[model samples]
Target: MVSSSLFNRASKVFPGGVNSPVRYYTPEPIYFARAKGTKLLDEEGKEYLDFSMGFGAVFTGYANSDILDTQMEIFANPVPEGVVNEKEIILGEMINEAVPSMEMMRFTNSGTEATMHAIRLARAFTGRDIIVKMNGGFHGAHDYVLIGAGSGAATFGTPTSPGIPEEIGKTVLVGEFNHRESLEQIFEKHGNNIAAVIVEPIMGNMGVILPEPCFLEFLRDITEAHGALLIFDEVITGFRFRYGAYQDMIGIRPDLTTMGKIIGGGLPVGVFGGREEIMKNISPQGKVYQSGTFSANPYTMATGIATLEYLKKIDYQSTIRLACWIEDKLKPYEDMGLKVNRAYNMFTPFFNQQRVWDYPSAVASDSLKFMTFFRGLLKHGIYLSPGQFETSFVGPAHSPESVEMAAFKMVYTLENEMNESGNA
Candidate 1:
């Protein structure tokens, strides 16, 4: 009742009663009272085993003691935004050291800013206008990224959102996730006009899709051949699988890399960096302009440092173990005509029978039935990502017991309660 009432009040001010489109649902989104690790307690005092994990931002888990300690230190010191701080320098060094391709980098307020600036930097450095993005790949909410986004934007019923000038869309080219010929055709035609090919090496916003073998290497080679920069958008995938960027694991160094989410330690942050010759193009060195009052704020930098420090010592295999346990339990989902796609610890149960490898396949999932299962799980004290297009993450925060309980409830719901009629 309190959550319902809060939603009613919020509706009067915020559009759709939510700041983010993915946060809204039919009955009304539940307001969280508090969160710790993989648990979220609602205003109604209902506890949920959280599989969303701050939409893949809370890598080390929510309300972590180390992050809390950093908060306390910031409070005692009263570090304000819009100042150069030693903490920022330390965080920059940590990221550059982890992802060697990022010889130099710049921090921003959000992933959108990072990608927007990266696109501009690429254009300025190359003196070309076109940016090619994968069909389902989501860089951020900026205009160029939103043009050809997949399921994430599809939640709002449009892959190419309105209000963007027609000319802006012309600057971006769309390519298939795993298919190589799509890129071949695009570059063959517009290679000279292309400033960069911005892509998500491992797609996350369109659910967890891994790259095909040699696909990334091909991207590296083709971009170099055409004189275009290769940019890896690691907003969600940066540290999701390992301590470093995904490009490093694949042995391909992108000309630029954009990162956020986990690197921020549950705080708002974004970073874009690459080879020294290219990064120097950003303002204070070259002409491309990018600045924010919150950029390199002390709080986020200190919190990130604490998170990386904690991350260095923990065993990431724990997350994989949890995923494997749920995968075994959810084998019944396949029997129910659903497919679960996983990349390391992040996974999604698509309402499609075939394996999902790209944007087209991801879009084919039965979203209506997914909402039915989603509602059923919610009633059973589980909080998954609200859309079929979104991903469910397991981190150090999730325990085996919580995952087991969630799996059992999910199975029970699919077996006895599901209608496939969109009726919860």
Candidate 2:
């Protein structure tokens, strides 16, 4: 039997016995002892291929040799007090150089911090009160952005968390993901009072929902016409989909952008950047204030610099080709009455027959069927995210061999699930 002792001890200390609610499982959670490359070993020593990738943070993969070496080098020499370290400077310069819109960048501890600061900056810059967000998009656990979380939040069917005050929640306005008309209506009514419109650009949190054609351009046009700032929450899509920002691929630029995941090279890091005139509104330049003691620590900076250096030399088209291969293998599952959707290296296999477009469609996926598929994949030594609403990630470590293995496991799991459901 799996151990419940760690969870039992943890429950009394941490709320839900996990640092984040998404990590919690229904029957029991497996405790991982160690992880390397694309695999993780549980406490009981069972090995499974890991597609979670620390919730899409480990783009280069776990325990990368170059990142490890950089970490060691930073630890060997402590930086002098009151002096800015070279690693931090280099990482900042790399971001600004690669992403054209980022004239100035500020680091934060997590994506939540980056987004929270971005919203504040928008409010400060535009002098407006209301903020707009996509219906199923998740920015972070912060009150403003938590208006509509996708998986665990959607599983419970309460998109809005309980602790967030209704008064504070009222400041947030929700719009459909790809529906331009819904956003237009919201802007038509509250356009004058709106300060910023924050979006995922590619909605990874809601199971890799790609924005409708010209959807991002529409946001840019609307926000600019209304004198509000557009903020692309590229925490997941930043470095993974492309070299800099996914916006570059979309061919539209937001006034401000928030980034996370691959930026830290697996360490905890977040950053928000945009034009210099708008960025200068932040503290030390203007009144809007944000600060963190360990925002640009040497350890994370070293790892980030090393990761970017390696990423700069690699070919993105080759990585995208691998993603297409995985998607092609799973495409036949539609014949089994399952709806499989994918974008770049992120993909999802929904149990329902209908195409998932918005929050309602995403939640309409059969939960029981998904649970069985998830458990079967786990038994077959392939690890998927515990919740169906979460996207399964592929990275540099996931070779074509591993993708084939995962495809076989998925096919077997789907067949078994269909047989059990009397639909085979």
Candidate 3:
């Protein structure tokens, strides 16, 4: 009947009363019945202005009509299995046009699979075993990207999840983001053995931390100098920023790029693409093997194509304007010693005053204060990412008025709850 009651039922079968670890917070998680546009309806039929945006997966907003229409059309006319479809070609071409680095492409069911295969491709191509990842960058649930990851891992204070073999951990070398010296040290020690250096051009997992000026250039140069591939794990930042990948906007080109979230138009999909020479190495074509039963399923392909096409027609400047407006409203709270990081339409308000350039800075944020702020905002009909480490997203569906209201709620929460606890 209510979120609490539904959570009680969920706890019986699911761990921590939710399917995903990040979905469950201290007292309880809000169970949503449905979503439309920029609002979510919980089990109690209460509406909240949604800023989580399905963890950056719903950039076009919940239940976008164009994506839905394409989905319906595809389902009406089913295609035979083991046959390539037109939607796949159209979507891939659009993606390649937007991101020129994707000379070749492959589709998968989730971001985890795309990242995993991308790593494998790198190792096979370079004939090396080591993977160098940013300390707080989260690629996915896969073992290779889990070492010192952020997001739910950071939220739970468990950088290294259990059940992952010690051997897997050894292959991954973690370095601080925005700190070139840290990476240089790793390269000096194991440059010859490194297969690739994977990073998120703009970090979403560690709450929207931006890459410092020329930081991405540093990565590109170093990886090239080391004879290793540079992988941009753009799963969260991909279409959320632009129609293309975020790397393009930063003026850096990686050897490989992994994308998910927004491209699916709120469905489940992941794509990896890179230089033709590197992609040629993938199986049926080369030695490294990767395949999925639902790879580029017609349904997802159609929606992805529709989503990109629609995005190309819209003026994203308005969304950015609204985000800036929200940021302006929240600046007073920042003056009181809170750090707010914004990247395009997505942002995060870290409870710490210091700018979060790396994992240590991100971890230094006051988690308890964030919890209080989060709960207070929830009470005011604003939905935020449950985890402090995760980024909050706003889309075209979120109007200026809605954002202003959310910003007002944020300030109120900061003044009443955060200040009461001596956080502000």
Residues 1-424, model 1: lDDT tens digits: 9989999999999999999998998888889999988889999899988999889999888888867888788879977668787899999999989999999999998999999999999999999998888887888788878876323311111238888777787777888878898888788888998999999888888787889999999999999999999999999888777788878878999999999989989899999999999999888998889899889888889888999888887778888888888778887678677888888888888888878888889999988888998988988999889889899999987888888888889889889778755657
List pairs with backbone clashes in candidate 3: none
Question: Higher lDDT: candidate 2 or 3?
Answer: 3
Q: What is the C-alpha local distance difference test score of each model?
A: 0.86, 0.82, 0.85
Q: Predictions ranked by lDDT, top down?
A: 1, 3, 2
Clashes of each: 0, 0, 0
As for lDDT, the candidate ahead, 1 or 2, is 1
**Full ranking by TM-score:** 1, 3, 2
RMSD to native, candidate 1: 3.1
**The 10-residue segment with the lowest total lDDT in model 1:** 149-158
Candidate 3, residue 284: Cα displacement in angstroms equals 0.5
- Against the true structure, candidate 2 reaches a TM-score of 0.94
For candidate 1, the lDDT comes to: 0.86
Per-residue alpha-carbon lDDT of candidate 3 for residues 23-68, written as tens digits (9 for 90 to 100): 8886677888899988999888789999998888888887778677
Deviation (Å) of 200 in candidate 3: 0.4
Residue range 95-166, candidate 2, lDDT tens digits: 998888888989887999999999999998988878888887889888888775224211111238788776
Deviating ranges (above 4 Å) for candidate 2:
80-83, 148-159, 418-424
